[model samples]
Target: MLPQHADPIVAIATAPGRGAVGIVRVSGKGLAPFVRALIGREPRPREATYGPWRAADGQAIDHGLSLWFPAPHSYTGEDVLELQGHGGPVVLQLLLARCLEVAQTALPGLRLARAGEFTERAFLNDKLDLAQAEAVADLIDASTEAAARSAARSLAGAFSQRVHALRDALIHLRMLVEATLDFPEEEIDFLQKADAEGQLQRLRSALAQLQAEARQGALLRDGLQVVIAGQPNAGKSSLLNALAGAELAIVTPIAGTTRDVVQQTIQIEGVPLHVTDTAGLRDSPEVDEVERIGIERAWQRIHGADAVLFLHDLTRWREPRYRVGDANILRGLPEGVPVLHVWNKVDQAGDELPRGDSDIVLSAKHGTGLDALRQRLLQLAGWQSGSEGLFMARERHLRALARVGEHLEQAQGLLTRAADQLDLLAEELRLAQHALGEITGEFTADDLLGVIFSRFCIGK
Candidate 1:
């Protein structure tokens, strides 16, 4: 009942299609007038009333339940109304159109809601912070039950609360440092103070621990990308088929049956693994241009992966000299990217499989040595598949934590320097605090919110 000029925004809150019910949501000021024009009665706040929804000309549309959540307490922190009707596509469309016509007459400033606009408004009104707001979408889009529960925890501010705790601790430390700086007489003592150094070390330790958790969470959310690469018929595809426990990839005795990179996504020990088996790398003069293209693309995938499993067929590669440029592949891979040397088809050559240099001899056909390979993969990923204490996170969160870590490292270096630049230390602490804030969206850009929420489904 606030005013007449604020146009109500309307959209179908429920997903499109036939279902048990569909929800049409409208939010804005002057919601009462819009409801009055549509249903001929103003609904009590937070009440559900069975009503016959109608058009501007007083024609019945559909019989449904109307819910009114008025003003600052609503999801978007506005006067909001929802109409739940039977969900036939045509019926839902007609109901939506009828409501829109009523809104157009009853309110002003109304327009089609943009992607994530409702959530954006909720954020602006302080109903939720950026991290919690993002969790709303994450929960809805969660692919697994565990993922949904983790996201729900984040939406409830579990992640943000921890971040805030760290922020508060950092602020206190910065205050103490700056206070000592104000008294130049004590600055020398403070610079050499054991307590001060101890506090800094403790803070760094806490940040490091948080970074580890954030990393685990990110892996839970994004999973790990593992690509298998080597010469043709080195059991790359066979290995994939074995791990997947199904015929996800076609394996034949003939080499090059897999012309393109074959991919399969499987959850092992709760860690999502995106496994790719690429076409073999060979220098065959008989091969055509298309095969060459696949080989080039194979290398690209290998370079982009989180980890590469370089397989060497022991029957063919008898000695270390015959090992497929094992040194060259290691050199080409980016530093810090883990490589697993797998000697496949070991069943064919028992004691002949190379023993030195961290090699695991396995037969993809018999599923021998698979458990060892799995353990190795989990180790490289920094945790076992389906490991406990995992949560859902993202690259944005990790990058923010990493920035904080870098700042802390830089501050430690400055503290050890000859100069007692307390001011510089304070600046680094501030930067670290800001970086941590970005993880929970206490400090962020509008574009970032757009990007994060845009990834959500339309109804969300």
Candidate 2:
């Protein structure tokens, strides 16, 4: 533990704004004296007592409730105190100040809690594992119903349970390998009798399934950024509004009406897609300074997007000027980013069809062919429409799982390559175990812990 972890910490537990109620929380060892100084009494443990908060001068500061939790029972496994009162910023500040003032005399080494310090303490105290600790933040930051549900599952140990399952299987396999290496004479027979090859293959199969599910979870947490790009009046804004099912961007027949990016988050099959409608892509002497800036920003966003929806005006596809502008946009799109050729105004295009077989023709004005477009976006994201057992996961989890798979692959090769591979096989298994431990933070570094926790909201 760091020296700072030994000291008591205090902070306003609620958001920094007026609410119906607010909380000022404190946690540390030997917080009894500090509690009595602020509340005038210890009250019952785990119970809320309504009373008046009096100052050192015997003046009433405010009337509210206080709850007490002794060590090994509270959120941080320390003696914790919570002062609940009006949610006004001033009242919360005054209450926070009173705790500090009383701590100066009643308690020593008391200071404000750092962001995520409280939850970090919870993990250190064995109240929650590292995965659950991260889930606490994920649950708060979830933006969609599916994301919130997945995060809630993770907080409930769904992800941790899966990781634990993998770790247990790996440990079992390691034990068998170690036992074989112990008896050099019986090495081959021991492995064969225990079916070591079978275990490795099964483990690899299970890991593949886990990787697919984790990819979905990561996609749920961090959705794809889809940028709508095309010539002016290709109905780029119309496509955005149509996909979002709202008039988020100003749609006018006049070209260059949308002079800025319009972004909106829309969910397809419970997967969030952050769709951005950039200014119409065009380079013309008629373009003004503001439109030029918008066009520049559009390209920047296009380069960063995970996917691009290159919208085309079907009604003017025969025009030489329109075809040239469309060709220019196709050339400008960033390489490696998946591009979906979307043809809008199909209702106005009559029987004329685009040359590309895969081009999606849609009438943004009438909402026709929208279902096909949504399905295509989901396909581009690699989302299985009805995948079961999905949970919230970070990019780090995916990397760790990938590393484990790599080590396992090496171990499997050793099983077949040579009989003298016992020592090498054991080393590979050990590395795989270490990689698995990183997911749940059983083998995490202090600096990584700091980086992870610091992203959390204060007083968490």
Candidate 3:
């Protein structure tokens, strides 16, 4: 905790808007005097008391409900006070000003809270761990219902519980290895009797399973980026519209109808896919300046995409010039990005389909073949259909878990690929446990904690 964190803090807990009701919250070491001065009475603990909030002039500022929570039991593990009144911006601001004015005389060292300060206090007080603290922000910023549910689970400590389980098993293994290392004369017999090799294998298997699920959760939080790219009039915009079920982008027979990047987020099986439609990729002397810029941006988007839908016109499949253009687009595509070959205009192909392996054949105008495309997009995003009970994880969590797995792999190698030198094995186990601690913040740095909580809402 920092020196400034000791001061009493106040803020408008509700959103900045006009609604039926709003809240002005205060948290500090001893807020009873402030609450009594602001509301003309000290409300009972954990109970709402209706009263008229009075100013120093003995006039009513507003009539509202005041709820009090004594220290160590409140959200921030401090004495909490909430004033619920009308939800006008002016009303909230007045209440906030009133708190500051009263604080000058009643509650010393009081000030307005910074962004995420309230939640940071809660974390410092041990009311919630690092993972749950993150889920607080995730829940508020969730873009989809599935994401909200997963965040709720995480806030309730689902992710932390799994990490704790791993930690407990790890502790047991570390204990066995340490006991053996402390007595090297008994190291080999001790390890063989305790079945240390079997324990290591089982722990690694469990870690792999958790890592796989965390990857899926990460996709749910950070949606996949899919780019639609091809030559002019190849139905790129139509495919985007078909996926979105809306006319988001202009569709026409003209080449480069889409002169800019148009993006839409569509959920398939509750997993978000941010699909981008770009201008046609082509080389022609008749290209305009704006069209050339659009083509350059199209390549930029393609290079960044997790998956690229390289749409082709089935009606023009046999032409040598069209094939050359298609080959050019393929050559420009960045390596390692998964490309799905899609042949469009199937309804007008007249049975002369492209004689090659196409991932999908569709008529975007008629809304055909979209279901397969949606499933393929989900696959590319690594989403499993009907997956429930997932944790809302970030890239940092995944990296920590990966490092844990790596250390465990190294530990297994020390046990099998070397002599009975138990010291190195014990160090590997220590590193593995340290990595597991990072996920729940048992071994996190202060700067990392600052970065995590700084992203949260101020009122949290």
Candidate 4:
């Protein structure tokens, strides 16, 4: 029998606040007694029964539908109970209180679940692997339709299957190498005859492809952070509004109109880009205390940004002062962050649409060249559009895959260096398999699991 937690857990599974209906879930081993005490009888497994949810004193709490899923066939591989009732917060609380009250005697030690405990139990019970369990949270937290679809695919085992396939191949290759090491006396070149080198080559190729897909998925999970910075009246706020397609920021011709950072998350071809518009960068004794604070905040955002869109006024580019100001701002930019030099307000510059290899020219006010800018932002994000096989992935997953790749590279190097170094090659292959196993929780640390599951909302 599978190991199971003895204590029962209860929680309001639905989102907080009033809605048409709400669900209260209970999970544990042998919850039939608790169900009987609350509803006054046993519920047929897998069947929803309409009844009055009663208190210990037989007082009716609320009439609703109740579902019972027996152990080994339910989520968490435990006896599960679900109460669907009116979504009034008060009503749900009363029902939840009743369940806890009944559990005090009928199912002692029943308590509220910790964040992600439900899914964590599912993982422990073999209902889902580590990646699939994570996908549950990703699906719930998906910010876009594309993200949601990809998360669904992950929850359905798309990503896990790929990892498993790679792991199986690694295991096969490791077995062959280990066997060769065991038979050092039979120096008949069994590896070459078994095509071990060919197998290693194919595994490397597969890992590279999987790594690319995982990178794209990680980008989807953690969207790009783009900060827009420029001098006052450089159309920074205007570009923010243009990108967001909403008047989210107060756009004014007056310099330093945006004295605080304004943020908007806009989607380009289904990839989310978090854009921040910051206060103008100009030093003057007339700059007020609040504007100075905003300028400081702008620099902070730029330093943390994945990409920076440094807006330059095309109309003022010819001015000596403007050129000097641009150079100073450029000097202050953080090293290693990709920055796009954007020239805005071509209309005011009285110039035809200009294009260059290193800069993008656009009139943010008229929406000219906006599409090109959007496409450029996507490109900088390393996004691959229209990849139907993409699935949601976390940074941890990427790190695991990267480690696997490194181990594989080391193994390949050892194999190519000398055929007699089979022992070293076997060890590297074993390390690679172990690294790949971490992705699916075949091998993982308890502390890492704690960190991963702690971020989930309570009740999963």
> What would the C-alpha RMSD of candidate 4 be, to one decimal place?
1.7
Assess candidate 1 and give its lDDT.
0.78
lDDT of 2 at 42: 90
Assess candidate 2 and give its TM-score to the true structure: 0.96
For 1-460, candidate 1 gives per-residue lDDT tens digits of 1232244577777776789898887887757887787778888888899979876566778899999888898998888888998988888889877876666667656665666767766776688888788888777766666567677877888778778888988888787778777776753665455366677798889888777876776665666899998887788999999989998877888867778888987765666788999988776785678788888888899889999998888887755644545555556666677878898887888674466677788899999999988877778778644545444677888888889989988888877762567788889999999999887677888778778867765534
Residue-by-residue lDDT tens digits, candidate 2, 1-460 = 8899999999998987779999989999999988888888898999989998887788888899999999999999989998888899988888888888998899988999999999999999988889889989998989888888888888889998988998899999899888877877763677788888999999999999888888999999999999999989988898888888888999899989999999999998789999999999898999999999999999999999999999888889899988999888888887899999998888888785874877788888999999999999999999998876678999999999999999999998999963788899999999999998988889999999999999989889
313, model 2: CA deviation in Å?
0.5
Q: Model-by-model lDDT, in order?
A: 0.78, 0.90, 0.88, 0.88
Q: Of 2 and 4, which scores higher on TM-score?
A: 4
Return the lDDT, model 3, position 197. Answer: 93
Give each prediction's root-mean-square deviation over alpha carbons. 3.8, 1.6, 1.6, 1.7
How high is each candidate's TM-score? 0.87, 0.96, 0.96, 0.97
Q: Model 2 — which ten-residue stretch has the worst lDDT?
A: 182-191
lDDT of 3 at 80: 93
User: Which pairs of residues collide in candidate 3?
Assistant: none
Clash count (model 3, backbone only): 0
TM-score preference between candidates 1 and 4, better one: 4
How many residue pairs clash per model?
A: 4, 0, 0, 0
**Candidate 4 regions off by >4 Å?**
1-5, 352-355
Reference-based TM-score, model 4: 0.97
Q: Give the runs in model 3 whose Cα sits over 4 Å from its true position.
A: 355-358, 417-420
Where does model 1 exceed 4 Å of error? 1-8, 57-59, 181-195, 319-336, 384-390, 413-420
